[model samples]
Target: MQVTTTADPAEFMATAGDWLVREPVENNVLLVHALDPNGVPPGDREPVFATVTDAGAVVGTAFARSPYRMTISDMPAEAAVALAEHLAKEGEPVPGVNGPTGAATAFSARWTELTGQRVGNERAQWIMRCTETTRPVNPDGRPRLATEDDQDVVAEWFTAGMRDSGLSPEEILRRTQHMVGGQIANQRLIVWETSAGEAAGAAGWNPPLHGVVRPSGVFVSPNHRDGGIATLVLGEVVARALEDGADACVCTHFLKYESMLAVVEKVGFRRLVDVVEHIYE
Candidate 1:
């Protein structure tokens, strides 16, 4: 197995585009970045890209924006270990790694051996996909596209949601502004308001890449719990995404976020895989 690195986004895509496209949902993060390298969270710097090949065919891929964990796609255990060892030797300062549980386990173990950093299992989440929309029971109100005037409130909610999910303080700070700015700039941020015109919830999605779009930043305020507002808003979000030419809508949320899980499933999303994230400081 040989692992080659590339800094040029186009070059990395050209090398592993086919493999990633073949399993776009599984490689959603990489696909989104390849389409728009600036799409990731802020404070993300010094991108590291690697394509693992055996007998001259692409077998696996990995990416990291330094100071954060690496995200990797499915690969042989040996390849995963080699990639971790290679990155450590190359002086990569990664805070953690995220991927399928088995692959992350292998990579984190090897990384520990190489760097003496204790590996900590951070969280587990589920990757879900919806190919067909279930008719959503629209509640009392309509979905409203958030406007510029709503930035402050929306950013607060976005940041709060990140914090609630146990995202690191550094990550929450780094990403809040970009998350709010990008969502509004892209016209993807939305709010669900009640018949009384009270904004009960908000959610957003990235632009479609490789015919796949992932919706996130979904939140319903505490005053409005168990109202099916999230279901109403997210159902529309997923439908609009697919209608906009996305072949599928993908999402990954913490397993502990039962409300998100319930709403997504009710709206026709089927669980694809459970991903475990590991951190090595």
Candidate 2:
């Protein structure tokens, strides 16, 4: 019934983590942020975390850092509207909203109504989960754990992905530098290589949370497209997670990435939910 904001990730998790885990696949993003020990990485934009509570129980949750859209799990439309009002009232600059279909739409509409901003673009994100991964029978490349030597290229590719999402340069640097290094250090980031030693593609899985591991930062080199590199790397990573005891492997991708969709399906992924990201003008 009331919206509250915090700077503490611990508080965010303490309040919202239980509700978030109720739908792990749908709330994977927030769960990652909440569980991340290396929080925010000195970004240019301040971090924001909020939860809607009624009688001491969390009912809705959202998190944001400027230059990046606010992200939430599924929540009541009224809860989403209250979140928009809370952010707007705080003079927080919300460039967009991303979440489940109804929640995202409600938040965007409320944000626009309060701020007089126009919705500019929208993207559909598919949350996919794979329990049984089908690796390439004869992949063009073989999977290997990334190393310090591979850091720059992996960071570069991930930054490019952040750019495509409209992230500001500073925020992109904060995220990729911190994220890529952490993933590589943990040996979770994997690169698919050609017999000739070319890095054809890369993918990584987060630490399992609630028995679910989300594979992310997936990318295939431009020259490697259509050679099944994405599927090769992703399948290998998810298969390893499952082998390591992950109950399910989840990931989200833009619906516009037709080729990636095909790759995911080939790796035995099926849709779990449809999410939306709405940008403002």
Candidate 3:
């Protein structure tokens, strides 16, 4: 297998767009940042993209932005190893890897073998997809787009939801702002509010790609945890996603979050795959 690397974001998208689009939900995070059509340029450290070809056909792809996790498609073990070795030799400091569990493990192991950096299983999450709309038995509120005034609250909730992650507070704040801002700009950040004008919960979906919309950043404040507020909010988001022309609505929640998992399942989302994040210092 041969891995071709590129520094030009446009070139990488041109080369891997079709491949990534083929499995939009499964590759949602990668495509959203890599193909960022919002005219956002790469940060101080340029993002790197790679395509693994075997016998003249692209078999896998990867994207790595410094100080952030690297993401790869479900590639063969050999291809994973090749990509790892290439990144290691190129002196790329891959803080972590995220993708299909098997592929991620394969790449993480190879990176450890090559660079002597120990790998830790950071987290695992389930990728769920919904094709039909679902509604709570007794929906309490309607879903609406979040306004700019809601930014601070939305960012706070997002940051709180990420508390268990390894990101420093500063990193979390930056990421939350970027994510929430993007969702707001796209008018995709949805808020479910009570009749009393209280925001009970919120959820958002990435801009649709290849007919698929990825549900993300679903969170309910601690005070609103009970009474199935999350279900009503997520159900509305999924239903709207379908009505908005998305052929599928996909999402990921930590495997250990049984409550969220049940909510998604109750909303007609079928589990597709388990994604694991492997981190290396």
What are the per-residue Cα lDDT tens digits for candidate 3 across 44-92?
4777888888987778888887767788888999999999989998998
Task: Give the clashing residue pairs of candidate 1, or none.
Answer: none
Give the TM-score ranking, best first: 2, 3, 1
Ten consecutive residues with minimal summed lDDT in candidate 1? 37-46
lDDT of 2 by residue, 186-221 (tens): 888998899888998788778888888888688888
Best by lDDT: 2
Measured with C-alpha atoms, the lDDT of residue 16 in candidate 3 is 76
**Candidate 3: minimum summed lDDT over ten consecutive residues — where?**
35-44
How high is the CA lDDT of each candidate model? 0.81, 0.83, 0.82
Model 1, position 181, has a per-residue lDDT of 77
Query: Candidate 1: which stretches are off by over 4 Å?
Result: 135-139, 164-170
TM-scores of all predicted structures: 0.92, 0.94, 0.92
Model 3, residue 116: what's the lDDT? Answer: 84
- Could you tell me how far off, in angstroms, the CA of residue 31 lies in candidate 1 after the best superposition? 0.6
- 2 against 3, candidate with superior lDDT: 2
User: Model 2 RMSD to the real structure?
Assistant: 1.7
- The candidate, 1 or 3, that scores higher on lDDT is 3
